[model samples]
Target: MPKLIKDGRVVDDQWQGEILQPEQIPESPAAPVAVQLEPGQGPATIPCALSNLGLVTIFFPAFTDGRCFSYARELRESGYTGEIRATGHFIRDQLFYLQRCGFNAFQFAEEVDLDACLASLSDFSESYQAAVDQPEPLFLRR
Candidate 1:
């Protein structure tokens, strides 16, 4: 079992969802599927089954593409309260932002050092903006 950073710790990843590609999603699935959300599709365009999925993985096709961040936020707002895993070639610096957008797990590309990635989650004691983990901005508390 490969390890992934989950909620700020390295844990054994027990991911069970099948990675379904775009072309293969039209067919109904018997088992739970983890589909990737690209940069442009609206929430309405996503299959209803996906909203009910227990584990959804956001795909980062490249380092520069950032549409997945909004997708995670949308999924949470839409009431899909399952595990959201950020996978692919995202930079380590994006971990905190990823969590703020509702990603609970991160499966970095094979080249990333998991230890350093895990440490980054605790790099800062506070953030000024509102996030999923910290819904209120620091300014509001003062």
Candidate 2:
């Protein structure tokens, strides 16, 4: 089993279902399908049974790839209530920002320290602007 940062703690990835491509979703799946999306892809692109999805795993092909950030935010804004997992080459430094964009689960490489990455999630006390997790900006909150 692989471990991942989920809801601020390191936990085993409980997903036992196959992660399929958007077009590969079966017309009637036995379990809620988990989909893997490219950086620029959206959940709407899934061929069918969009509402039956349990998780959406977004891949960060490289540390410099920032396009996934927008896709995560877009998923939240579009009312996706399933898990938005961040997987691949993103650094621990980006965890805080990724959470702000609505990624609730993170799967780093095998060598990465889960403890250190969990700590980085709280690197900042607050944010100046509104985000998915924090709807009110600091200015408005005050």
Cα lDDT listed for each candidate: 0.76, 0.86
Q: Per-residue alpha-carbon lDDT of model 1 for 22-81, expressed as tens digits?
A: 455665666666666666753455564664465777778886887888888888877777
Which clashing pairs does model 2 show? Answer: none
Candidate achieving the largest TM-score: 2
Q: What would the TM-scores of all predictions be?
A: 0.82, 0.91
Model 2, span 1-142: residue lDDT tens:
8899998999999999889888888777777889998766765677656568899999888968888888888888877878989988889999999999999999985479898778889889989999999988999988
| Model 1 stretches with alpha carbons more than 4 Å out | 22-32, 49-51
Model 2, residue 62: C-alpha shift (Å): 0.5
Quote the positional error of residue 20 for candidate 2 in Å: 0.5
Specify the highest-lDDT model's number.
2
For model 2, the stretches where C-alpha displacement exceeds 4 angstroms are 26-30
**What alpha-carbon RMSD in Å does predicted model 1 have with respect to the real structure?**
2.5
lDDT at 24, model 2: 87
